[model samples]
Target: MARNGRSERGATIIDVARRAGVSAMTVSRVINGRSSVRPETRAAVERAIEALAYTPNTAARSLVRSAELRIGIIYSNPSAAFMSEFLTGIYEEASSTGARLVLLKGEGGRPPAQAALKRFRKSALSGVILAPPLGETRSVLSAVRSWELPVAAIGAYDVDGVACVRIDDRSAAFEMTRHLLDLGHRKIGFVLGNPDQTASAERMAGFYAAIREVGGVEVKVAQGDFSYASGLVAGEQLLGGDERPTAIFASNDDMAAAIVSVAHRRHLDVPSELTVAGFDDTSAAVTLWPPLTTVHQPLRRLAAEALAAVTAAASAGSTVATCRAKILDHSIVKRESLAAPLGGADARSDPDA
Candidate 1:
């Protein structure tokens, strides 16, 4: 009798088990690279697998391994919009890896580092992924060291012994600033990012570098915390001044959107009376009436890469002692929010101009 389509495809675990004179579970364990199976049983299963041409589904095999491995993610960033995208990336990769992700919540009244340590110690986490602010702190890295587990830092500064995956914040910021300068924007205003995160400092440095490169320009800066609320305050401060800038470059999209709102209330037409640009081409950038001109940071891909690094390190155990860093590229996305200042920024030096 001819075989059906399903059976004709290839040999299944059941066939391999029968050939090896073992149960399906035993064959599965052998196929999944489990170390607990008896040597003789494993040998028999291997012979059966080879003879029957049995091939395991890669995803199913990952699922089997994941059933045993658990990973933890620690974060302290205050931006809800940013964190949402960040977490989604981690979760997707974890699922693909066949590993369970444990979100380690606060423990005791201690800081994020201590809380992460407590939760990590209590759980069976094979590895840890540290998000910004938390990842940038030396104390947190020290705490992570005590655990001796594989550690990966995403969107954090490169440390000596921890794997890191990030985009060049300084370079991205530099390009965005240069883009604004190219559009005849000299008196450009800036809104700062979160002070606790290292990326904030890098971004500020980039902005300054761009300003120095074009010495004949004027610049103003307002402190912001990478939140919509902080952006609003920063926007008011920058726009309310008598020597207001013709262009504003916020460190993040939320703040840039807030600047647009401020410009609207002030009866200034965006890109005509004022031009705005931001970093992190996040969702809020496009949702605005006039889409923002910004830098595209691949946050999701960065998280996925970070998770892969940590998981690989975890699986490798002590053999992988050295830290590794992966730097991804970013691009400047032009949109309706930016344009050459009316006439020229130098020509509109007067506050009302």
Candidate 2:
């Protein structure tokens, strides 16, 4: 039998709701045995489920409600905007799932990750989520493995025996660079993120790849640590030069916003005289004047997925046996911070027009 315009083999919650003539939430309530659902409605949902052969994703749904999960999150990220967004996502999921979260701030000069891990060792955490650049740190990953805890690393690439959730930083950077190139930017400045993180390298590689694809593009590179302070320094270095780039792409939003600040300080009109682009599409992107054009990295979703992965493994009393990398999608977000260079394409050809 047809299941609400879909094949009967893999019916979803929506299909069951359609068949029952009820909302998806009502169907969910019935499925989860919530007492608030009316008996008549519950009966309808069950009948629909049986008729459509709908099999709910019990693993995904039950893990949250079935048990209380104690999860530890270790972070020492420099970007406040990024950390804020990441924590918000984790809190949202934890609140819904009734999971208790232990936030450990990596502190002190002796490798902040190790400091946090030392604290974590004393806590009764069922699983741990390592936030970058901690996630990419070999020593930290090794320490977590030694603890025999189920682990999920956020924004780390190519590590063994851990679950990871991240966007394709390389592809996202490439797309952002292409966006600037398409906007008639031939001389572009790039602000690099923290050297410790793998994502920084990936983004740099992506920018260069795009530049190579379109020959004759002049590029300027500056160092940043994904922080406003680093951005300020980088911005000064890039904008201080005699020959300024028409467009600048910072590795993340915080730095991008800094670049904008530097431009303003230099009395350069944004978009008209300079176009600035950022990555991560963090809160900093929109909070600034002329909302930043950036690559939308799903920071919230990444955190949510990482939480889920670690929690699932913790609940199962096992570590993720092999590396399970869940790469999420990213998109290029266009905003007021970007525009065609002054004098347009003709400016590139004209020597003294």
> Under the 3 Å rule for N, CA and C atoms, how many clashes does model 2 have?
0
Across 58-152, the per-residue lDDT of candidate 2 in tens digits comes to 68567645657788888888888999999999999778657799987766322455665777777777788888888877787788888888788
Per-residue lDDT tens digits for candidate 1, residues 1-353, read 88986467677665676699864545655766767689999999999999988877676556646566677888766566677788888888778767778785443312475654776668877778888766777777788777888778887776776777789999999889987777677789999998877899999999998878765678889999888889999999999989899899999998999999999999999988899998878888888879999999888988877776666555434312226467889999999998888886555333332
Candidate with maximal lDDT: 2
Report how far off residue 283 is in candidate 2 (Å).
0.6
Candidate 1 residue pairs in backbone clash: 66-98
At residue 75, give the lDDT of candidate 2: 84
Clashing pairs for predicted structure model 2, backbone only: none
Per-candidate TM-scores read: 0.76, 0.80
